[model samples]
Target: MPIYSSDSDSYDVSSSSTRLFQRERPLHSILGGGRVADVLLWRKKNVSAAILLGLTVIWCLFEVFEYQFLTLLCHIAITVLLFIFIWTNGASLLNRSPPKIPEIILSASAFKQVAVTFHAELNRSLIVLYDIACGKDLTLFLLAIASLWILSVVGTYFSSLNLMYLGFVAIGTIPALYERYEHEVDYLAGKSNRDLRKLYKKFDSKVLNKIPRGPIKQKKSK
Candidate 1:
């Protein structure tokens, strides 16, 4: 028998089980089930912390300090080149072997594969957008419109860099927190979903169904 933990509103099961929004898959599997998931979930705590720290420093440099990316890149390159130049000269004077830099090459096939994948994904997104615009699915169309409206509202408040940093922070923290308290999160999510559905039904019956409509022409089978 497996041990079960219970809270006032949520129950945790220590076994393979489906949860809301997880689509019958484990959280780790849903997150790609590899090093990426490990880092996101804090399985590699040091790596995750280091990545967050690095991102925070970059965000601070760009947003708080107003550093331009190209200027920073050139400064970094100059510093690195200067250090290497001095090291090589000092090594020659000391009769020591200079640093051996590995050659970096861009593979054509890898680039082609990436381009092809990007093209396919872009086409797929365009198709979805077209369908939504065409009103192929009313619910999906409404959802897309609502999402865009929310994004636009958010954009009014935050700059692009601020939004990006907030998104990065959310990505770094939300998944680990969800995995830790998934039972409670899923329970609350399910409850909220049910409530939303009930509200939608009420609105549909009261408002949408009350709207005047023309007679629908049924498609005839040939």
Candidate 2:
């Protein structure tokens, strides 16, 4: 009974496109937007950032007030309650018709999936190590290893609570700081890369290339 005009269709399309564009505005505007958001997915990343900040504050309070046992007790209670809830009412609370899956089959499938994921990740890690072994991006690889080693050493000197507090604070603050001063950070990063490359080139020319080659023992004739 009703006829739609071309103009009306075009208007509807344009309005929808405009709404989508507005919706797609970078999440980094509110938090760290780019690669960080991409890796975690934006909403989850924001929630994680919020949790990190909140926990950091709570950790500081606990440390300052010397309520370490209280923190442990709270964590244990929460864990126990979570497990009880999940075991008891979780199925009903899901509000879906009961799954037809056999429990053993489901568990086996889950284990298989976990094994596949573990294998994939192990292979990926080995590939990264192999690349590092081959001296690809050697400087960056060494820097990452050095950073991890330094963190391990530093962590040993701090109490678990203090280390956790620092970890959460760093997680929450660093991304936000980088997001706020992204252009400056990028500029500095670019400059550092250039300097590093120059240094690497100089080292290669003056030192690495000058190393005497080891004598190659030829294979004996059969």
Candidate 3:
């Protein structure tokens, strides 16, 4: 019985160790375990599908149909108002009740929380950018340059809205796909990371090490 229990414990440990990044927590928890994470991970499949469909429709309207935002907004508002007006007036003659519109009072706390989160993220990004600018981390500097260059190239081919739509689609799909095939993805990622490190070390030795630096001067004691 003791040997069997020990084998079971070993199995559990091995199983967990094999998980992507050897994460102690589940992917949902890593993604905040909130409604947003649920949608992204497709825990609520209907909601996720609806959101993606809505975004695709909007993207099509803007990109394929060349629809203006204000024009679409006004047209929707007009149609809604017309329907509501007809329902309210026609209900009296038809001996029926008018459509009830639900009140949508926005919460101040929700806005405040969103603002705080955005501010924190912005500050964190700025700090990273500052460090990259200061040449504090060579790897980060190269990564920043490469990312910006890629963005520039992509921008030349796609508009801002196209990029946003693509990003949303990626966010909606990538997490779920990764969660499903995490073991394989992690293995590939680990291999690529090791290869990148080797390349970086080689580059550092060949080029960076050859760069000359000025001697540091000592301050005189008063």
Candidate rank order under TM-score: 3, 1, 2
Indicate whether candidate 1 or candidate 2 has the larger lDDT. 1
Model 3 C-alpha lDDT per residue in residues 1-222, reported as the tens digit of each score: 111124322332223345554578889998878898899999999999999999999999999999999999999999999999999999999999998855433667777888987898799879868989898867668878999999999999999999999999999999999987765666555455557788999999999899998999999999
Candidate 1 whole-model C-alpha lDDT, 0 to 1: 0.82
lDDT of 2 by residue, 114-176 (tens): 798679869988997788767777886877788889989998899888887777677666755
What are the clashing pairs of model 2?
Answer: 28-33
TM-scores, in order shown?
0.74, 0.50, 0.77
Task: State residue 163's C-alpha deviation in candidate 1, in Å.
Answer: 1.0
After superposition, the stretches of candidate 3 with alpha carbons farther than 4 Å from their true spots are 1-25, 92-97, 104-113, 120-137, 218-222
Q: Root-mean-square deviation of each candidate, in angstroms?
A: 4.6, 14.7, 6.4
lDDT (Cα, tens digit) per residue for candidate 1, span 1-222: 333446443344444254665478888987769787899999999999999999999999999899999998999899999989999999989999897765433667767877986798699879968989999866557778999999999999999999998999999999999988886667666555656677888999999999999999999999
lDDT against the true structure, per candidate, is: 0.82, 0.64, 0.81
**Residue 103 lDDT in model 2?**
85
Question: Lowest lDDT 10-mer window, candidate 1?
Answer: 7-16
Show where candidate 2 strays beyond 4 Å. 1-53, 69-134, 216-222
